[model samples]
Target: MTGARRDSCDVAVIGAGMAGMATALFAAERGLSCIQVGNPGGILFASGLLDLFGVHPVAERRLWRSPYAAIAALAREQSDHPLARIDASSIRTAFEIFVAALGAAGLRYAPLGDRNRSVLTSIGTIKTTFGVPLSMVAGVDALEARPPCLLVDFRGLREFNARQIAESLGHRWPDLRHRRIEFPGTEAAPELYAAHLARALESRQTRERTIALVKPLLGDALAVGFPAVLGLARASEVHAAFEAGLEMPVFEIPTMPTSVPGLRLLGALETAVSARGVRRRHQASVRALAFDREAGTAALDVEGVPGVERVVARAVVLATGRFTGRGLTADRGQVRESILGIPVLQPASREAWHQRDFLDPSGHAVNRAGLAIDDAWRPLDADGKPVWPRLFAVGSILAHQDWMRSKCGSGLAISTAWAAMEQVARQLRGTGAG
Candidate 1:
């Protein structure tokens, strides 16, 4: 490894997904000199929905708590700690601020309430709204307390199975009424759809056209659902305006591989971080970390162009993501810690790794395989001691939780990063590091 004396920042966040970006931003806002180092696109490979909760209706109350409760728990643990320092209220406030910043940067997000019922998508599949199952779409009345509903879809977009969804749910709630409306054009060109709607809205033609199209179908309907793509960030305001003019409750169904809301969030977060002067180094993989306990700092060995370089920082946040992102690894007959060699909490044998089938929705229950961190979010040794005074962990890197199966990836990232930043801030204040 080539040794280089690089400029040291108060915190060096490794990874640039929602978690990493949030940690860096919060750290910088606290007057900490923060540097974000990681691959260019952190979570581009998987779906990007900021799923706060996905507990099935049957397990909701027993398995998981409400969003507010989770945030409160994070706040309680992070307050006065060392890593980045912010509170629960500040966390929510920061999210809103970040949203506004995104809006100003040409991206937007519509806050859907805490209802987790699934809604029918144009493709005919049902997606859980808050945490409700998509299979329950047929029971519309029971799901949303609304009457017969209409499902809308863009003509060009395929892969939706409205027929199957109707068939499955209809068996239980035959009274539910279903209809289809296909928007013009191909699904390939999203910008085209967004632009067409934007111009129509700007010219007042969209409102008129929408009324003409929906008047016959809605004659007297109360609610409707459509593909999440309907609310493209660039045109969300226009879409919302149109929805208001139509006087209908239009809910968006989650789509595949980076749903509409997920895409919007990814774009919004990148824009927000960039505007804050945080230099994001994407596609740069971190290979290892060397810590200097005496200096209360660490140097990250990153692999990319110009060979390897050791980056020094007073603190580091690891948000490399979950299994799909390669943050956690499972090899033949062995499960090893990919980065930092952090001790893992794993099964006794490969046979215990998971159940029989790969597609089993139960997923691998090995939540203990993630990075082991103390209450302060600092990496912990096998002896259960903080490994490095300045090194911190966040997001999927933390062990003791399985975000994918738990349906808490977004919440875990957001809340943990918020807590990590709060702790970092306390550390800075107490030690005068920054």
Candidate 2:
């Protein structure tokens, strides 16, 4: 550690998942010199929908119309839940800020409201979520109205099958129809990917040709729905052009992951954080982290490069996420925090990790295994004390809640980052550390 290259920042955020990005964005917004470490591989799996709260009492799988109401109920019943612990107003504000930042970065979302909207998935199933991207907002209205609509899919795009979606929902709306068409220049191509198609749509020629092919298939349909592949960076323009050319409300149904929307989301976040002066180490991972009590700073050894480099920060936020993101690692014995070996609150034994049934109503116990944090958002050690004065944990890494089943992943990430950064800023200013 003696001769390694070193840099200092007001805050060093570990991980580049939703939570980590939010932490860095908020930290930079507060004028904190921020350093963000880790790859953003986790974000590529995003569905592009910001879910605040959709299901509560996850055991029942009950869906809620108003996220605020669901959050209130969770607070009353499951007071320890992260989303429940945060006030509705704060959560709302956090979503607003996060969405606005994305909008500023060219990934605009529909105006967020109090009620949750039902979005049609690529598979024809409906999903309840709080915030809908502008490109897909029309699907919300189409779902509510159930008007005569035409669903279109490219012949080579195996991920999206318009016929399948139409048939799946045919019982509910008999008038719904579907068609498959050859993409403008992919007639000879046997298969098509959403990302490539999204980029192609950005070209005027491709957009017009694709629109011409669909215009004839419109028939009696009042609206048109396609897979979420309008455009990559220029989604708004492509969506607007489609609506004008088709002379109808056009919408996008979110396809499965490794999708165009996910890519767009990641790009926008990177843009937002970078615009705010947050240094990125997207190709790096934190190898070792040590806190210097006397210096009131934390030293992080970032790997994934030619040589190790150290980053010193007044405060540190761990947003490494859950198993998939490797924030928590598992073994024959128990789940352990990936970094610093912080105490993880898991089930008694591996036997209790899962129930006999895969689809258990209450969910598997391992989904709730994560670090336990105190009120200040600081991860607790074995003795139930803060691991460090400025060490904080956010997102799915925290225990006592199942974000996936609860359908509050975005809310948990954004709100916790916002709350934790508030404490970080206050502490730094109070101690005159930054």
Candidate 3:
């Protein structure tokens, strides 16, 4: 066996989803050396709208204008929910630092406030979310005002039909109209993707050509809405050019999953953490994790890249995401924690996992199945104690919360990460390891 020394750090964060990224970011910002692992699947599906809380008391589908109020209700109603455990001030500070980092990485957001804003989606539906990218903020105002607006789409872009969107909501918003035009340079392609169009628009010539085509069509349009294809790396510049050329407010409605906004979020988060000096392992998965009880460190075996690599850290943060990210696995009998096989707090049996009616308004019991943590955010074993003193868990993996239904996906991920990182900092530094 090679006697080479292995890489060491203050923290090893598993799962490359938003929660994992936040954990690593928070750790690094607090002066802890961190290494993060996992693929980028989670962030790629994001809509780039950070939802703190929109719906609460899932059974009633109650929507809230102020997320702070929603949390207050959640705390009083569902005290066991992970998000309820995080105080309001810490959550605010967490979002502030998280968004500031993203802005620095070229993804600016409108200043966050207590109230949530409604954004138009491609399906003619409105999504209530807190954090809005500067490029998409105008869409919020346009939707609220329902003024004369032109919804634009390219000819070959599937899954997004401007006319359908306008028709669906036209009765309620009569001033809304839609127009379809051929993209400047994609006449022969027969099909187009948001990411591809976004990259093309980064070129001044292509952006100008596209703007010229839309300029003549903007007859009485006070606002212009396009698919979220402003640009990839230079989205801000491309968005500005469209707004300037059209002499009106230009906004983008986020497309379905695997979109340009999602790509931008993934890239920006990666850049943000990397810039803060956090090490990363992209397209990699952890093979095994073991704790050195005497040394107070964790050892991880990761599989994916060239050779099987090992990582050791003084503390470990399990940000491994839920089902989609494969941080939790389910069988015919139970949903088990993916990496460590820790006891997952799930339904009594598979039979009870879901309601008899698939569309039950309250949602399924299994949706809340995940690791149960203590006050310090450490995942508990069967005996109801932390698996390890230096170990923690964050994000959707925590039991007793349904991020999707609550519309607090980013908040759950970011807030839990912040709250847990605080405990991690204290434990490590309290032991003189920092």
Candidate 4:
């Protein structure tokens, strides 16, 4: 253990997904020293559009124009839900701060409001989300008016198809047209990826050439849409250039996962948290965690690059997420929390994990299985008491809520993180630790 290093902070965050990132950002903003652990690659699954609450009562598939109204209904119907426990004011403030941090990192968004916007997906389906990136905001308007628009795609980009999108919405949007063009300098390549195309567009010469190719193709079209391959780091500039070169409103439809938008989102978040002075263990994972009840601190064993390093903090926030994040694991018998053997709130038997129908509207029982938390956002032990005074849980790792079906994944992450951090700060102040 001679080569191993030791560090301390006010808070140590586990996981680098949206929830973990939000927690670290909020902690740093509140003058708390923070060290974040786990790989950030999970953020690649994001679509860049943040959903705050679009659906309620998963069984009914009811959509909502206003997320606050949906939350009200959710609180009335399902009081145990983690999201229902948070008030509307706090949720709004959390989103505002989160979005502003992203904007400062160069990823600007359209102004947020009380309503959810309808965004067009790669497969021509409309998704209701609260926060829309500026690059994709035009699609919301185009989708609303059903205007005459041109959709463009590259020849070898397999993930996105402009023709398919037009075909899917043909009946409802008759004037929507589709076109395909060979991306400049990629004609020899048999397959074009979204990330590569996005990087290529960052070069002004390449961006101008691509715009030239599309300008001739846009005839009598009020607006134009493309697969979200606008410049990766300099997306705002590239998007503006396209609208100027084409002399019309331009939009981007989110493609499949591992997309350029996801990359941009991750990069901006890293920038946001780093600027606020949060230390990051980008290549590390927590091997083991122990709490010193009498000392009022938690020790984390982080396994990473050189060797295993120890990180102690006055408070620890678990945003490790669910099955994909390995925060909760299951075997033949039952599901259990991954670290520290915290009791997981799950089905009584493995047989009840899923419903008879695979596509049940209510979702599988297993999807809602996770660690149960007390009123202060701390994970509860078997007896329904907080395991530790400063050990708290946030994000999808909490039970009694299915974020995917409810369309509140981002909401659950950001809002709970904000609420939990408030408690963490207050508790640390009372204990006078760090």
Q: Give the winner by lDDT.
A: 4
lDDT of 4 by residue, 1-434 (tens): 35679999999999999999999999999999999998874588999999999898899999999999999999999998998999999999999999999999999999999999999999988899999999999899999998899999999999999999999999999999999999999989999999999999999999999998999999889999999999898999999999999999999999999988899999999999999999999899999999988888899999987679999999999999998998989999988888888999999999999999999998999999999988899999999889998999999999999999999989999999999999999999998854
Residue pairs with colliding backbones in model 2 are none
Question: For every model in order, what is the number of clashing pairs?
Answer: 27, 0, 0, 0
RMSD of each: 6.0, 1.0, 1.1, 0.9
Q: Give a tens-digit lDDT track for model 2, residues 133-211.
A: 9989988998899999999999989999999999999999888899999999998999899999999999999999999
Q: Estimate, for each residue in 186-274, the C-alpha lDDT of model 3 and write its tens digit.
A: 88988889899999999999999999999898888899999999999888889999989889999999998898899999989999999
Q: What root-mean-square deviation over C-alphas does model 3 reach?
A: 1.1
Q: Give the TM-score of candidate 3.
A: 0.98
Please identify model 4 stretches exceeding 4 Å from their true place: 1-3
Question: lDDT tens digits, residues 1-434, model 1?
Answer: 65643556778888887678778777766778777876534455333334554442212322333544543453354332221233446546555554455566665444534434444544444443232212123333334464666655444445444455556667654544555554532335543343243244444464456545655776555655555544444445655654676676655455554444445556666777777777655657778888787877788877775566677877887777656556777777655566876776677787887767766655664653677677788877789887777678887767655565555665566667878887888887777786
TM per candidate comes to 0.75, 0.98, 0.98, 0.99
TM-score of 1: 0.75
The C-alpha local distance difference test score for the whole of candidate 4 amounts to: 0.93
Candidate 1 deviant stretches above 4 angstroms = 1-7, 39-49, 53-143, 171-182, 185-216, 244-247, 293-295, 305-310, 356-363
Please report, as a residue range, the 10-residue window in candidate 4 with the lowest summed lDDT.
37-46
